[model samples]
Target: MTLSVHWRLDPAAEPRRSEPGAWQRLPALARDRRVSTQNRFDYFLQVAQAAAQTAFDGLFVRHRIEADESRIIAAIIARAVPHIHVVPEFPASVGSAVYAAKQATTFQRAAHDRLGWAIAPDAEPAGREAQADFVSDGDLAQRLDEFLTVARGVHRERPFSFKGSYFEVENGGFDAPLNRASFPRVYLQGSGDAALALSGRHADMHLFAPASTEALAKDIARLNALADGRSVAAGLIQPLLVRDERQTAERDARDRPLAPGTLVASYDEAAEILAGFAAIGITELVLEATPTLEEAYRIGQHLLPRLRALTSAARQAA
Candidate 1:
């Protein structure tokens, strides 16, 4: 099977020097402090295009609370990038699933045949309160289930209805022409039992967060079992650190202790690392090669070739 590879849109994974956060990194690019907004956008476009060239199947973009919207950015990306799929996280609780379905179709206009919907099923109590304008505290799990029902229902040729604890939709359907893939694939990221079970029943893919290798393995197994016979891609998000050789990788890891992250050593070592992940049933990898553009290019140029070469082999062996 072909392994699905994904990368992020955020060029600066670490907090910027002027930003308030635990760790800060200054930009090392040749550009000066007098960077214009358009210049910044162009820089990101450069990295994005590089990622596209490197053969990432998809791109993930995180949503900023009220400040920066992800849908607009995703649509723009869909237009710029040729065929790469874009999955932007939407807080499902923010709006009706019907709204999300229609919105997903509209967003697909730009990315047509290259869009997937990744939803944040719920938020912490404090965060939910802040979004009182959008969603409220309730059985978010049930809400998520209802959402999946409504979304899938609307995408079908026949009208669909649902009666549930949280949502009720009657004869709901979409008339707009769908992307080549029809409705965008739905994805969810969460580890709770409710999340896992619902994801098994609804999501085409389940996105995993950073965790120990062993932890991720166990979660993948549980999700696979929960999915029964249905096909669902299991994905992990990792930040990688790679080098030409094992010693170089080790030295870099030591030099940047805080950012050591996942060490992908030589091409052979990288293949072995990927093999291990595939052995544990990971079909998708969404990773950050580095926080800055330089590191992004370095990893993209170096490790990407190895990744592309060996992922399918590893999966076949598994």
Candidate 2:
């Protein structure tokens, strides 16, 4: 299996709480507005360029109610940086499946088939209702299933027809240039049985929140069983705070207090941990760090090469 690394991009500036004295500083309203129009596009483009320079395989544009729209950011970055995949996460209920597919088709054509779709899970009750009518989890799963079904159907062939509880299409499909583009890779996140089953049916890659190695191994095994021979790549969304020495790493962790499950270690230890994850079937990793601009280069310069070398040796030994 090949291991691919992707950097997570936040459309708006992320809180710099992890940096020294960041929390103590007063907010700068003038600086905050820099991410508004053209500057926002420049920020995303710069990040994309940095990720590509670091040899990352893709950029994962995050989705959140407070953030700028993910797909638009992704499109802008994708156009500016053509070498890496640009994945945008969004709720499946945002638009008609056929229309979404049409937009995706256009994106694929423009970006040379480098577009990816990470379908965001349903938000909280009020947030969910804001996107679409409130529905049970079971119904939501069914709706997503149908949504992907129609989106993919229209992309692959003409006159595709589908009738589902949440969606219905009659002789609906794309034409000529639209039908010729390849479908975007589908990415789904969650560890529950329902999420696993849904991913097994459709997702090319399934992402899991950071977990203990043993727990992650078990989750991968369960997802594989659910896939029942389908090829569903396993991945993890993790944050990393690595340094040259163990003491420095520990000091940084003490100062930053990162999320639980973030890997805080020396470069060598971090490589070993990530390689261990690869050994257990994690072929993809979406990694993030605070102040993304500098951290992108830091990880790419120090950690990524070590991890790649370790995984390579493991592959050779096997």
Q: Name the candidate that leads on lDDT.
A: 2
How well is each residue in 193-303 modelled by candidate 2, as lDDT tens digits? 989988999999999999878999999999999997799999999998889998898898888758667888899999999899999999999999877888898898889
Per-candidate local distance difference test: 0.70, 0.87
Question: Deviation in angstroms for 255 in model 2?
Answer: 2.6
TM-score of each: 0.81, 0.90
Candidate 1 lDDT tens digits, 74-187: 777778878888887777666787787877777766566688878854667887777773444556767777888888787774477888876788887776465233688888
Clashes of 2: 0
Ten-residue region with minimum lDDT total, candidate 1: 15-24
Q: In model 1, which regions exceed 4 Å deviation?
A: 11-40, 133-138, 176-181, 211-214, 246-268, 315-318
| Per-structure clash totals for the candidates | 0, 0
Question: Cα RMSD to native, each candidate?
Answer: 4.6, 4.2
lDDT for position 197 in model 2: 89
Q: Where in model 2 is the C-alpha error above 4 Å?
A: 13-38
Model 1 residue 161 lDDT? 81
Candidate 2 Cα lDDT to native: 0.87
